[model samples]
Target: MSTIVFLHAHPDDEASQTAGTMRLAADAGHRVVCVYATNGDHGTLPTDLAEEETIVLRRRAEAEASGQVLGTARVAWLDYADSGMTGWDQNGHEESFHAADLDEAAGRLAAILDEEDADVVVGYDWHGGYGHPDHVKVHHVARRAVELAARRPRYLEATMNRDHLRRIFRAGVEAGLFPEDEGFDPDRPADDGNPIGTPEAELHWHVDVRPVLASKRAALACHASQEDVGWMLGMPEDQYAMAFGDEWLSEPGRPEGIEDGLPF
Candidate 1:
């Protein structure tokens, strides 16, 4: 059986970004694992540390539930704190993922990859899918894992295409979901796009997951705290399904025999 591992920035990331693919892989009897780079402690809070702890706990539970829904065999965490986007004060905090030891982090992930004997390892693109320090770190570690493992593992990076992003943004704008002033910014690169990152054709491999879109949404709903349910309200279910029906994967050195087709 082939083993597939997804390395992500936070808890809900797996669900929102690639739940359908994971589900499809699992349904096909592959061993699937999710590795979370952080506990997602800094996402949001109720003004109390205790409350925040409760939220983190809840988010972990939600992650577990979502993993089950996607048929993931295991979930692992690097236990780092969430580092808010580029300009946020949290970016420089010593406790944030940005401050964590990159070599050590890579070693930890490498260990997981070794143990799982992963055939395919998935992570974010080079820009960290929007330059999130944690996401970037994940990409680094995933690359390291492939390098350190005894057997070479195919490293796949998750990303979107320029055309698809434009369409999604335009649709959001036309539907009044996003303000007209929301335009891409090249200077402050992180400020230019989605919470995750945009896609680049050079670094991505596209796969249509239309058959398992419903499972993807179900997995997304599992992470109630991270996602804003209201954002999905305005979009029609069919539209939502169509828009998220595809996923992208990119590896440093393309694996032989892994053709471009439905992963399942």
Candidate 2:
């Protein structure tokens, strides 16, 4: 069986973007591992954190629990601090992921790729889906790691399908399920001033993950400390499935698209 490594920006990021993919790979007898770029030191303050526990500790614990729910065999952290948002002051901190040395960060991940003998590795889209600094750094570092690793694993950039999101939002608005004026706009500039995701024409793979959507939601539920997740979990089941049931990927320079399983 092949080993699949998923490199994510923060703790709950894996649950949101790749939980279903990880579970599916594990169920198929493949080794599934998750590597987080940061410990999420700058994430929203948890109201429930114990006096002895800091945000970093709480977030790491949540990530590990999330990995367990997704059937991931191993979970690793690169030990970088969270680079808050795009323009946040923390972005300039030496220990922040956004400010980490590129070669150093890539070397760390490259070592993991070599150790795991990974067959495939997944990272975020070019703009990291929504332009978060840590996420954009993930794109660069993961790609660099693939280039540096001796294993030379196949690389796939995980991304949302912008067109699909727009369509879903539009339909939801028409159905009055989502308020027409309050609905998300995928085309709007995000954290780093880039639009949400790549267009359909640029995508290479669309993996149907509805089979593991339940596991995905369960994985997300593990990060209860993140208040943002509450709104997501409260979303209507059908809407949640419609929005997350399909995981999209892009292989640079690939022209063909797959709507089923991964090449592995």
Candidate 3:
């Protein structure tokens, strides 16, 4: 069986963007692993955390639980501090992922790619899907890892379909079910000053993960530390499925079209 490696920016990121795809790959008897870029040290402070549990500790524990839910065989961390949002003070910290040496970081990730003998490698879109420093760094480091690794895997960039998200939002608004989410303008610049995601015309793969959506939600639910993820979990079942049932993807430099599955 082929092995697939998913490289993500933070803990809950895997759950949001690639869990369903990971689960599907596992279900087909392929090996699936997750490599997180940071320790998520800057994650939201959850009131429910135990007094002894630091954010870093809590987030990694959550990541392990999420991996279990997603059927991931192994979960690894790059061990860098989370680079807070685009303009946060922590982005400049030496230990922050944003500031890490590119070759060094890519070398670390490439080690895993080599170890796993990854057949398919997944990372984020060019703008890291929303432009968080760590996310954008993920794009850069993953690409560099692609160059560093001896294993030649098919690389797929995980991304949302902007047009699809807009359509969903519009329908929700028309039905009065979803008020314009405050501060969320799909057309407006996101953390990286880029729009939310690539246009549908530029999206290449549309993996129908609805069959595994339950596992995806379960994975996301493990990261209760983040309010945004919790809010996502609160959506009605059908609505949640409607929003997350399909996991969209793209190739590094490919212009877009219909591709049914990851390269085998």
Best by lDDT: 2
Clashing residue pairs in candidate 3 (N, C-alpha, C atoms within 3 angstroms)? none
Give the alpha-carbon lDDT of every model: 0.75, 0.90, 0.87
lDDT (10s digit) by residue, model 2, range 1-264:
999999999999988897888898899999998999999887789987888999999988999899889889999989999998888899999999999999999999999999999989999899999999999999999999999999799999999999988998898888767888794899999998888999988888878889999999999999988878998899999878877888888988777665558656
lDDT of 3 by residue, 157-196 (tens): 8988899888887777777667766445688889878899
Best by TM-score: 2
**Global local distance difference test of model 3:** 0.87
lDDT of 1 by residue, 1-264 (tens): 789999989888887678888998898899999999888887755344463367678778878999989999999887778888767887787767777777777777888888998888887787776777777778788888788877878777886555566677677678765566978433334542444444454543566777888788888877766545435534577667646777876666555332455443
Q: Native-vs-model 1 lDDT? A: 0.75
Ten-residue stretch with the least lDDT total in model 1: 184-193
Error of 1 at 138 (Å): 1.2
Ranking by TM-score: 2, 3, 1
For model 3, the superposed segments whose C-alpha errors exceed 4 Å read 180-184, 253-255, 261-264
